[model samples]
Target: MPAADQNATPPGFGITLDTAAAEPRVVVTGELDLLTSPQLQEALAGLIADENSRRVVADLTGVTFFDSSALNVVLHAQRQAGERDVELAVVPSPAVSRVIELTGVAEHLSVADDPRP
Candidate 1:
């Protein structure tokens, strides 16, 4: 079996996890659609499972594309976060913002400003 890189990046996509801060942040890049949504969901799920992860910020500023599937994954993560007593926030790209606006999912998520430093 191949060993997994702690910084494993999916094909055509990348995820950066920063857990040192008060709130863990997951920065995603590349296209987010049906094919890549599962990878994102899995990453979010791991964050939710962590006991120290009381709050999570998903920074999608680097996302070039997004779709309904991507929206659903974020929504699901939000719901799971609630169940785990974790607060979830998202820094969406313009493309993601458009879908959230169209689907009325924005109200359900805490949208944060991009926190890249």
Candidate 2:
């Protein structure tokens, strides 16, 4: 069999993780959709599994796009965290804040400003 292209990106277009935790903080910056949702999913899974982490903050400042699939991923993460008795915050960027508000999911999330440098 032929070897697959190594440099080529995976099925997802743009999905990356940046862990910024000063004691307790998880900043995720990237686009999440049908393709890249798994990355976020994995992060959420890891957080909820950690008993010491009481809060999980998702920094969406770098994300310029949003869709139903992305929303679903977040919602699922919310539920997962809730089940584990953890708090989930959605730190929406100025760009994505309006869309999240319009979608009516903002109320449920702990909407905060992006603390990016």
| Top-TM-score structure, candidate number | 1
Residue 12 shift from truth in candidate 1, angstroms: 4.5
Question: Residue 81's C-alpha lDDT in candidate 2?
Answer: 80
Candidate 2: count the clashes: 0
Against the unseen true structure, what C-alpha lDDT does each candidate score? 0.85, 0.67
Cα lDDT tens digits for candidate 1, 40-96? 898899988899887888989889899889999999999999999998889988888
The lowest-lDDT stretch of 10 consecutive residues in candidate 1 is: 3-12
Pick by lDDT: which candidate is best? 1
* Per-prediction TM-score: 0.84, 0.73
Query: How many clashing residue pairs appear in each of the predictions shown?
Result: 0, 0
Residue 35 alpha-carbon offset, candidate 2, angstroms: 0.8
Which regions of candidate 2 deviate over 4 angstroms? 1-20, 23-26
Off by over 4 Å in 1: 1-12
